[model samples]
Target chain A: DVKVTQSSRYLVKRTGEKVFLECVQDMDHENMFWYRQDPGLGLRLIYFSYDVKMKEKGDIPEGYSVSREKKERFSLILESASTNQTSMYLCASSLGGGPNTGELFFGEGSRLTVL
Target chain B: TQLLEQSPQFLSIQEGENLTVYCNSSSVFSSLQWYRQEPGEGPVLLVTVVTGGEVKKLKRLTFQFGDARKDSSLHITAAQPGDTGLYLCALWAAGNKLTFGGGTRVLVKP
Candidate 1:
């Protein structure tokens, strides 16, 4: 089975502190994404990477940034964490193109709480 | 930007009941997918409907894609406790980005 692993299952950080959430996929998928899931707003895309060193901003990219230094690893960076940033962060990977490109394989998710 | 909207944000019912969830969008999509997420877990893909006016079934669940490719629906029959979870609908947009809906939280009691 394809596996998407998130480094942390839960995290707590102080306001204004820098935060990093890591994700790795073993399937060698070409597209990786970071999304923040909230109660009523759904899963909003923060950033996505189509290649190892290429990244694109998504719908909600104001408070977050991303890095894809390696094909398998994608990291979400919060320059300065705030209370409003507390939410469930999900990482997903999928085939870059072709017939099955739309099917995403997701990680277990990292729940972060900023105090 | 294309947006997908799901209705009935929350639902509660007893086992053996039937229910249906709707997903609507103003823009046309190449395909639509349905996912279910349990507590503490990531959303799992349930079904994908690509053709206009297409219908597919997975056991007790039935999925339909609108003729215009702008909407979809998921119906569950004899829902069990295991069916309790958040159901999300996503659209496969142009840039290979999947635009997700807000989701419907379903709770089934025995």
Candidate 2:
């Protein structure tokens, strides 16, 4: 079975602390994405990587950054965590092309709480 | 403003009852998809509609795309407790990305 694994299932951090969320996929997909989900806002994309070392900002990339140094690994970074950044983070991987051509497999999600 | 709007933000019904959720967008889309997210899991793709006026059925669920490509609907017949979850509608937007609606939270009681 295909799998997308998120390193942390839950995390608590102090405001202004640096944070890292790691994701790994076993499918060898070419496209990987990071999204933050909130109560009323739904899931907003933070960043997506289409290839190793290649990344693109999504609709809401304000306080977040991503690294994709390897094909199967994608990491989300919060330089200085803030209360507003507290949200459920999801990682997903998809076979090349786009959502129209294939389905996106998502990880279990990492819930981050900032104080 | 949200690119896509979903009606009936929350729904609670007894088992065996029928329910329908609507997703509307002022802007036409080339394709649309529906996803379901459970309590502690990420969203999972359920169905994708490409052609206008397309209808797809998955067991007790039925999905329909508007002929104008600006709307879609998901209907559940004889819903069970397992059907309870957050239902989201998404559209294929420019930049090869997907924009999702706020989502409809459904609760089915037995």
Candidate 3:
């Protein structure tokens, strides 16, 4: 079975601190995404990478950035964490981009709490 | 904003009951996906309907996409306790960016 692993399941950080959330997919997928899911509001994409070292901003990308230095790993960085940035962060990967974009394989998710 | 509205934000019923969830939208979608997410875990893909007026079934669950591809529904026969989870509907737009419905949380009492 394909596996997507996340660095942390839960984390706590002070407001204004920098935070990192990592995701690694063993399927060699060409697309990786980071999203924050909040109650009432569905999963809103923050960033997505279609290839190594290439990233694109999604709908909500103001306070977040991403890095895809390796094919299997994608990282989401909180430049400066704020109380409003606390939410359930999810990382997902799809096999490829465009016409054949298959179902996304998701990590267990990381829940961050900014104090 | 491309929005998909899901009905019955929460549903709770006995194990043997039957239920149906609805997902509606005014704008058309090229494809629709259904996902079931357990608490604290990521959402898992249940099925996807691409063509208009398509119907698919997985065991006791039936999914149908509207003729115009602007709506969809999920029906479960003889619900089980294991079916209790969050059901999300997603629509794929032009840029591979998916818009998801508000999601329905179901609880099956045993």
Candidate 4:
């Protein structure tokens, strides 16, 4: 089974503070993604990495950046955390890109609270 | 922008009841997937429907993709308390990214 693990299950930060959320996958998947799940908004992609040191901005990438220094690790960085950024963040990894790659396996998710 | 729409944002029913959730889109997709997520947990894939008008069954749940590959539906038979969770429908649009629906929250009480 594919195991995707997040660094923190719960976190709290003050406004304007920097926040970092980490994700690691044991499956050595080539594709990794960061998403925020909000009520009525679903899971909106924030950023994704296809390979080491490679990143792509998704639909809502503002105020957020990503790092993929290694294949098993993907990190999400918030330049300046705001109250609006308080939400559940999820990380996912997929085996490869193709018709039969299967569904993405996600971590338990990190719940962030901005004060 | 391709959008996946879900109906009945919330549903509450007693055990032994049946319900159907819908996911619709205006654009075509290569495959559609159904997932169930609990609070504080990420969504988990339950079924994946690839062919147009294809139907797949998993235990007490059934998934169907539209003939045009623009829509999908999930039906649960004799839902139980253990079946309570948020259901999400996702689509693979040729690209690597998977677009997900708004999600439907279901609660089944015994």
Task: Please provide TM-scores, in order, for all candidate models, with all chains considered together.
Answer: 0.96, 0.98, 0.96, 0.96
Per-residue CA lDDT of model 4 for A3-107, tens digit only, reads: 999999999999999999999999989999999999877788898888999998887899999999999999999989999999999999998766445779999
Q: Cα lDDT of all candidates, in order?
A: 0.92, 0.93, 0.90, 0.90
Best by DockQ: 2
- Model 3, backbone clash pairs (residues 3+ apart or across chains), number: 0
Q: DockQ winner between 2 and 3, please give it.
A: 2
Per-residue lDDT of candidate 2, residues B65-87 (tens digit): 99999999999999999999999
RMSD of each candidate? 1.5, 0.9, 1.2, 1.4
User: The CA-based lDDT of model 3 is what?
Assistant: 0.90
DockQ for every model comes to 0.59, 0.66, 0.60, 0.62
List candidate 3 stretches off by more than 4 Å: none
Docking class of 2: medium
Question: How well is each residue in B1-110 modelled by candidate 4, as lDDT tens digits?
Answer: 43999988999999999999999998887788888998778899998888999999999999999999888999999999999999999876445677788899999999
Runs off by more than 4 Å, candidate 2: none
Residue-level error in angstroms, candidate 2, position A44: 0.6
| lDDT (C-alpha) at residue B4 in model 3 | 85
Give the candidate number with the greatest lDDT: 2
Which is the leading candidate under TM-score?
2
